[model samples]
Target chain A: MRKITAALLITGLVSAGFAAKEEKKENLFEKKLMQDIKVLNEKIENLYKLHVKECAPEYIAKAEAYLDAIDGMSYINPDTGQIERTEISPMDKIIFENKARKYLAIAKEKVYSDADGDGIPCYQEIEQGTNPFEAEKKVSRAETEMKEQKVSEKPEVKKVGYQPLKMHARIHFDFDKYNIKKDYLPYLNVITRYLKAHDNLKIKIVGYTDSIGSKEYNDRLARKRAEAIKKYLIDHGISPDRIEIIGKGKEDYLFDNNTPLNRFTNRRAEFFVMEPTESQ
Target chain B: MRLLTAVIFSIFLTAGSYAETTTTELLDEAQNSIKAAFESGCPTYAPYEYYKAETYYRIAREETSKLNTKAGDAAAIKAIEWALKAMAKRYGEE
Candidate 1:
């Protein structure tokens, strides 16, 4: 009975010793994992500090989460009592780094790639409804300045009511001659001054005749008188295109051609200033 | 107590009068500046600056109409600033 009791005590002691040894081995593995986690945390903190300016806050937080996942991940080999790193894979690390790189690339683009060189980023220019590639097309300070000068240089010309100048001097001609008389020269000078001042004026010269000859002969004489006036105006620097001549030839007489005075009044050339059309 | 109430009412009336005067002055100055800028070709040349000035001036007018004197004064000052900026741009200054 004593020997059996001694054997039981020995077995109990051996069992306790084995349990303690196992606990020690487990503690060592846990200690190693804690150390690895600390190291990983430090590395993550360093990376975050280094790229805080370039990387966005969200990406940094995601990176930290990935580091945590890596740190918490471990697999135990039952046969060899070994811990395997199975938390974050190499591909996961690569993905995190790539994401960080993408953020950095975006930061670089914002800092350096100003397509218009208008002191505004391309993304901001797009938001402002301005051209990103063409610097001049955008509403830049320099372009605004140039536009200001152009606006000041050209004053707007307003169109008031159109009032055409009328030549009050009636052009009288000799009874038998188509030549313009000396008295009409002053009227022609006035017309020339007005035409020179306003290059836009157009004129109509109408010639009339008294009832003294055949209708055909009167028509020819009236035409010659109108042509004489037109030739005078063209010779005095007025454009030929601006003048239109017509011969009434004893039709629509202003005065009765019965007496010499009435005949003189009837046989005359009238100058009418034409108003500029609205389209002109 | 009645005397105190009358005094407080008078004070309120005076303050309201002062605020109205200040807002009116600010709005007048703003309008004058905007008119000058427009006449200087700000609308055609410095369109963006002119737009900003006009927007601020409109806001100032609206606020003044609503009797929001403080906001109206602030908006009027901003209007003047933008109008001057438009004029500067019109004169070929950056």
Candidate 2:
């Protein structure tokens, strides 16, 4: 009987050890992470409604990849093991959440940026209510056809809407990035329209950077910034032949690198307009 | 003389082939395992488990530096377990 009791006791102890080993750890950030993910999902959906996918496809793609990473996360019902919960460490959750928010902001900016410098946003033009895009133009097909045909020939210069003296404009860019900000897009729109109206005027866009990064990197970044403006103008209707892009890098600075505003002043794309010999 | 011989014999039997593992060895093993799990993309796919593994490994190193062999061994063992869990999570098994 003593031997049987010893055997039973040993079996009980071994089973208890196995039970302890099988218990799963609880995920601590289940509640907060779930809330954050829900909010991010709603923000992404709102951006989709604004048609961000068409304007800023890269940002949308990154946002989608981050959202996909949430799959296979932990926090399944610790009691019943029924439903899987959104489960990641607080640091990782913050990383993913902040990335999603950043991308969403970029996408939203692209959707709402004013393409023609009109007070109305691009989304307002795209939305089905009024469609001010074609309706507000009011130009006859004959005039548009004439304009298209004139592109290959010597074109008659139209009076530019903005003041001619405003030709020397500088647009500031975000730190270490080439994406044009929404505030600058309206000014760039004015430049695009001016270029379209005056094909004989060749404008050189000089890019500059702050004294922060390495020389080589700053030169490349400056070139990219100029190229970004060139691409925007070309996309809007400017002839590629009438525009020149140059990267001046960090050679010219408006202020010493002592403050944030000083650095911002240095990170700019400056325009210099020149008339052809015949126009002069 | 016989009692001394028996005592030594018993001590030899008890200590036979039982080389005690040091905290250094446990921590080194855990570090390698954690690195392997990270290379398997545990930080992206099994973020929580990987975080736990990294945290336990840090605690193990701190305890070992302080000469707290018992706590160091415990934390190193936990780090190894969490690393395995992270790898298992990557395979959709954990």
* Best prediction by DockQ: 2
Docking verdict class for candidate 2 = incorrect
Question: What TM-score would every model get versus the actual structure?
Answer: 0.31, 0.33
lDDT of 2 by residue, B1-94 (tens): 9999999998987886564666778889999999999899876566557766776676567556767555566667767887898788677452
Off by over 4 Å in 1: A1-168, B1-94
Please state the CAPRI-style docking class of candidate 1. Answer: incorrect
Winning candidate number (lDDT)? 2
Q: Which ten residues in a row have the lowest lDDT in candidate 1 chain A?
A: A155-164
Ten contiguous residues with the weakest lDDT in model 2 chain A: A158-167
Report the lDDT of model 2 for residue A1.
Answer: 100
